[model samples]
Target chain A: MTTGAYPSQSTARLTRERFRAGECRPTAGIAPGMTQTNLIALPRDWAWDFLLYAQRNPQACPVLEVTDPGDWHTGLAEGADLRTDLPRYRVWRDGVLAEEINDASACWEVHPDLVTFLIGCSFTFENALLEAGIEVRHITDNTNVPMYRTHLPCHPAGRLQGEVVVSMRPLPAAHIARASTITARYPGVHGAPIHVGDPKALGIVDLDRPDFGDPVRIEPGEIPVFWACGVTPQVAVMASNVPFALTHAPGHMFITDVPDSRYHV
Target chain B: MTTGAYPSQSTARLTRERFRAGECRPTAGIAPGMTQTNLIALPRDWAWDFLLYAQRNPQACPVLEVTDPGDWHTGLAEGADLRTDLPRYRVWRDGVLAEEINDASACWEVHPDLVTFLIGCSFTFENALLEAGIEVRHITDNTNVPMYRTHLPCHPAGRLQGEVVVSMRPLPAAHIARASTITARYPGVHGAPIHVGDPKALGIVDLDRPDFGDPVRIEPGEIPVFWACGVTPQVAVMASNVPFALTHAPGHMFITDVPDSRYHV
Candidate 1:
């Protein structure tokens, strides 16, 4: 969140400083090595089914740390505060965008009952992939990873239901297997590639177009490897249209105390 | 389920037969090489919170599969009749013990009903650990694994509340690292050892005294390695005593079609 002097603030230190100061912004590359999680805050009534849906779909909706209902901060992620820790949060009420806020501390009063769900994001694995000589197209190209709505239906739990969302990476076929083996180690974060070759197999009709995030190039000889995207639970939330919901923006992530490697299975 | 000629029927074939005959029995050693899951059935009203509890406590509760409310069978596990697959069922009414039944077909009714939760057991990983020359105490002692109620509390979901239950395995120091590395792969089942040495750290007063199952010896240099157990959920069920709850008896698992190796990470 620090402008030109960003290097002066470490990822963990900076995240805390920015979040505590109420400076809300996208935290994509804010913390280089620290694990950044996806935020999905739902009403107490809807928390269980959402949790079950995530359980049913681990490859996509890997949970990092979940808080007890009515508890704002879970002790798992160091001193990170769930209510105002993230840069920004989007509020969805009845499937409609209601308000975007720097923090939800004010909103918590409406329901002492709101539950927090911090899910593992692909960003954790993508950071790992980059360090291992793999060129993450979106990061290299300075755009969000291309995410699509797949035809594959998630095994429904209770009333929460939706299609699977996948983030694609165009890497060599050889790297697909290696990537699968590497990322699969971190089941806490969305681990491993769910689909390796075909986009259409996931009901994706076009390569250049995506349902979420920006599209990147698929260089020749590079096979498109798809990993379960964090957007999965969001889609379920939208479909359910519960009276109220809150999630971090597209690139913004909730920074955690956990290191990337430790999240491995 | 058949008293005569338990042989002549392969584990796979036998699973199908018992399922067809509406026989619900403990599926501990049945179906060699295949995975067996723990079942936790709750009312539609309590489904979400419990599912969330499972998500937060996956190591103690690996959700291998789940069924929508009112649905009895988990299509993932080859026509598994949740109502009558396991040999017996423990019914809980308002967090109190209602009764233990041989079959739940008579108890089951339409809508506002059963949500089957298939949790992973340690059987699959024990097979792998054994193959690797590690000693799984209960297996050697010819009895059920020693499970103890821990002082450590789980991240609760809604009305679902409880303590963490752990299964013990005594191993030498050298095997601890290898054991940790190997078992860490099966996140769908309880992953690696949550505790390597100190039992008191988990609020366990006496190693000889356990809340469930029998205790085994910790030879000189042989130490206890604990993995979160599925019994953790039952503790919550016992604490809440939600009316009309069902779960597999301790060690009596619900056999599944999925292979054990498939669950690695």
Candidate 2:
């Protein structure tokens, strides 16, 4: 829908309308200052475990809000219906990819015990990094931020457990400290960089080939920095082998009324 | 057994020793610089709702760590037993004050399904405030910090729901901004003053008579500042009328290996 091209207060509403009308697309750079979230829906029985998992590993899965069982609305975005507001959704059956859908309302109706979780996305903090005059390679290159699976294991909660996943950004060595300081303020998002320098430290052999998303160019003086990715929970949830689950497609986030400034210290 | 008189690295260990020996006393000023926590033990069944409630209200109930069902040890403090480390514990029966004891191990043994929650206490931030050269009135008076029930209702989760409870500190008008900034750095420990002036704004009437803790003197030109108190969860748990629950007694806290600086931004 290219809602980012028309940045305004109405961007969130317009983007949501397009998603409601079956237009599936990435949500990056849309609605400028507004916060966007990663969505995960699970049965009420597994919701507690997932909630605890988020609490135990907040940096990878910073939960903005969790809806009550069978509820689809979030207070972060007034009047926004979670069931069909996001551009696209991925449904999983027994930890395997089952279907890709424009809206999750049908799946949710079948799983009446569903609980929706709104998790903070790195896009919010990336906006802050841009405002701080730090260049974000992906946005400049018009591609999704490169992400990789890390050797770091997340603290397990109930049946949910998996390796941590991180998103990468490359910036000049001189700007690393400032970039960290700027992003650290938005803990609601992914917060500070988890690793800087050697990608091998996190077990990533090649920066050009990412586990998820697209790789961006690393200039001569630039160093790759990594932040915990919201995808960590999706991987963990899939590994748990739950009977069914619903999640926002990679880069297709649910826009909220909350502003990026709301997360700043 | 008054460990407050012995402020040293060994204070936490010595305090735990005293607690093990059945010396029940308040924990205020016992282990300076060491992070202290509020304890809440609930049945595994009710633990999910309480954990969700804490997640929904991080300022009031900043969860440092939550134990797996029937486990008493926490990573926050090595070798520290949640059942017996705190100098005193309060047992609630059907939402009413049942008994105050030296240790909760007995009640825990009887319940078999208890899940312990270690929640961050304001004492960590209070230590930062003192280091910032701000005077904490109750500490100066060698009394418990004055806490009051407020009109602000916490976001309810399942059976847990109640008004927010705040701890009051009267600081000079000029220091309010500095105090807010200092405390804001410690989001793990309540973080910043929720109310700066006008106690009546939070439905706090009669500053001299707080609903919890002792009243502290407020000199002229000083304004009453309020921070979300750990007591908020205790109040909510009580109102929910859980059959049995255990909490650290007012002013008695669980000493952890974590330092106040760990929470700093």
| lDDT of each residue in B129-220, candidate 1, tens digit only | 87798877776766667789998998777787899999888899999999998888887788888998999999899989878767787899
Q: What tens digits encode model 2's per-residue C-alpha lDDT throughout A1-265?
A: 1223334447777888888888977777778788889889999999888988988898999888888999988887767889898988989899887998987889777999899888989988777777878888888888887889898999999899988899899999999999989888778888889999989999899999998778789889899999998888778867778788899887789998777777777
TM-score of each candidate?
Answer: 0.84, 0.95
List ranges where model 1 is wrong by over 4 Å. A1-10, A16-26, A67-85, A93-113, A217-220, A237-244, B1-10, B13-28, B93-99, B109-112, B135-137, B172-174, B198-209, B217-221, B240-244
Whole-model lDDT values for every prediction = 0.76, 0.85
lDDT of 2 at A76: 79
* Candidate of highest lDDT: 2
Give the least accurate 10-residue stretch of model 2 chain A, judged by summed lDDT.
A1-10
What class would a CAPRI assessor give candidate 1's docking? Answer: medium
- Tens-place lDDT digits, model 1, residues A193-249: 888898888899997988877889889899999888887877887776767888886
